[model samples]
Target: MIKSCAVLGEQFVFRSLKEIMAKANEARSGDELARIAASSMKERMAAKQVLANLMLKEIREYPVLSPEQDDVSALIEEQVHEEIFKVIQNWTVADLREYVLEDQHEGADLLYIAKGLTSEMIAAVTKIMSNLDLIQAASKIEVKTTCQTTIGMKGVLASRAQPNHPSDNLAGMRASLYEALSYGIGDAVIGINPVIDTTENIYALLNETKSIIDEFQIPTQNCVLAHVTTQMRAIEKGASADLIFQSLAGTQAGNESFGISLSMLKEATALINEKGTAVGPHRWYFETGQGSELSAEAHYDIDQVTLEARCYGLARQFNPFLVNTVVGFIGPEYLYDSKQVTRAGLEDHFMGKMHGLPMGVDVCYTNHMNVDQNDMDNLSMLLGTAGVNFVIGVPMADDCMLNYQSLSYHDIATVRRILNQGPISIFKQWLEEYGIMENNRFTSKAGDPSIFMNGVLGGMK
Candidate 1:
């Protein structure tokens, strides 16, 4: 079917809803590479005009992929609350956008709206939103989840201690963890991206991080970013994992490329719920990024943003404790540079929050990307302001193993103070116990990792 709209007396016709979605997006290299981006600015506007008038029911009916052909699509269809959907089914995309921006419809209202939307409808609204539009609307919604500790509270920003080592060296990782802890970061989880994705290496890293938590009595969780199956295998072999980690995609074929499936995720969740050490459910950690589906050649001609939203659609079903978009790690081919990266970061955060998931972002870039620490700084502050659940903290904003740049411990601490936010409540109490923080601000002894070594700071001891 064809969709047509007129802009300033110029008629433009889009081949399908999928094409309209691609055309409506802000300039993205991946969309251009996929040859789905609009050929001209006028054409893009026309697409947006058509999309803005599209009914929620129409978007739901013309899914980019049919449910029978794609399990991800099926899952999304299965989760929509029919009673809720029927109420707002006639609303236009423009109406949905205005509703989110409206002051009266807040976090609870948005969560209710989320149950009535599919990933496509969410993507449709995002395509029409500007950066500030994304931020302002996202700030109104707060999605909190808990595993070992509760995160995503209002006026709180969390950080993941990514103590990654090039060789999976436990001591080296620990040194980074200490630095993160000293700065009162890592309240979300102590996670590692292992160089070796083997079960043995994953098991060892999980045990090492769990041991650190046990020894220090830290109110946090631990995880290794290996394949979900490998994490499951390690857990079966007696690895004490606080959360099982996996990277998700929006399509069945894309997930297949990642060696995951709906059934695999179901199995992993059940395993963690039973054997994992976390309390009160919400024990899964998932990561996503734009262009992953295209990179795997499984995108089916849909735009990256919509596929990215679908990733969140898949994640919400399992009640994940954490889900972040590694915004710039996909590099120049997809995100192109800092501007694109920044846009994607904001988009991912807003989309995830709209899905009612506890969302965060890995504010990072590869070495080859036309990005630097300044861009990371800007994006982090924006996301922090938008009430993101957490951000990744590596040593000095650099991950030695992953070979990328992200927020550092010091950077996170600085952001928290500037934004008048702090870590999770339990983690803040622990920080106070060690004198690392006082009155929602860092003390003189904050930056020294040695405080944890002695189990007590100077005044207490």
Candidate 2:
């Protein structure tokens, strides 16, 4: 394999594709912490140059994590279309980049070629692309999936109303959800991060949210983010959940650390399809972030970007209704600052879309990170402009249960207005009927949670 290259007359040698991939990534704290990052800017440039010249076949043959050792890798190998792979086998990573960005190439073209590409091949081009390159390329792709409703339409932007509570107080959650629905959010799903993870608690949350949806005739789904097994148990107990939620990682070991396996995911999918309340072939809602494998000490010396892309690789097999990257939730240890968080956000979105997964982003940050609401705003707007399928919305941008700051209901509304986009068509019609939104814009009644308490929402009072 080609493992060496020259830049500015200085020769650089990489030990393997893993090392090249790690060094070629834009600087991140996790890579530095893992001691796998390039020592200097010039060395990083050298790695990128070497990676750009390698043929797609060479990269695919030298899988960073072997199929024999990891089921995730094996599944990715099984999913790649061999015939399509043969057509582009000889292309260089640089050639692939140019092809994706070519003026005449459209979303369908990228989605077609994506069938042939491995996650490593996708990560290779990402390492050499600029931030805007990620945005522009991702903007062209539209990945749509259905649960209770379809998201990811070209002119539509959906949102998940995350009305999280620290103590699992039903009233507090319902209050937050009322505010969310008033602003035309929750079109993606009315999801919550419960302070408790027990099956009983999750069932209660799901039932409560479902009751609200049923009473108001809201056209969206509901989910309670919990351990997959716990969610499955709750579903078995007759919770009317439209989607099942779980956090995912790139490697088998990392997934084990999360207490999940491919088999477990398959079983959950089967259970949901048979017992769940959604009218769909798609039902899983997955979350991934960079550095998760590293955090679990399961990265196998691969870069976070590549590992993150592998998460998408595994997710593609599931045909998920929503796959989100909680891009900044892991803290400054991985992203470091607004700059790194913003870059990782765009990279994750582009990589997920490239994999043909219906992708969304929880453009968020924890308190310890060197990021602020303004940074979240920047990323949210960028992701929205890139045609993100949906985003997470919490009350006032603060989540009591998770203790992180995500985009607010107001923020999602503002982004939709600025981008000239609306929610899923069915949810939009419901909002119009409730006088919350009209002609694709918020009405005077929007943002007034009391609109629900005053018996306007189908006489709930």
Q: Which 10 residues in a row give candidate 2 its minimum summed lDDT?
A: 452-461
Q: Give the RMSD in angstroms, all C-alphas superposed, for model 1.
A: 1.2
**What would the per-residue lDDT of candidate 1 be over residues 1-461, giving only the tens digit for each residue?**
33998888889988788989999999999999999999889999999989999999999988999999999999999999999999999999999999999998888999898899999999999999999999998998988888999998999999999989999898888888988999998899999999998989999999999999988789999999999989999999999998998999999999999999999999998999999988857899999999999999999999999999999999999999999999999889899999999999999999999999999999999999999999999999999988899999999998888888999999999999999999999999988887888888888999898876666775664
Clashing pairs in 2: none
Q: What residue pairs are clashing in model 1?
A: none
lDDT of 2: 0.93
Query: CA shift at 440, candidate 2, in angstroms?
Result: 2.1
**Lowest lDDT 10-residue stretch of candidate 1:** 452-461
lDDT of 2 at 312: 96
TM-score of 2: 0.98
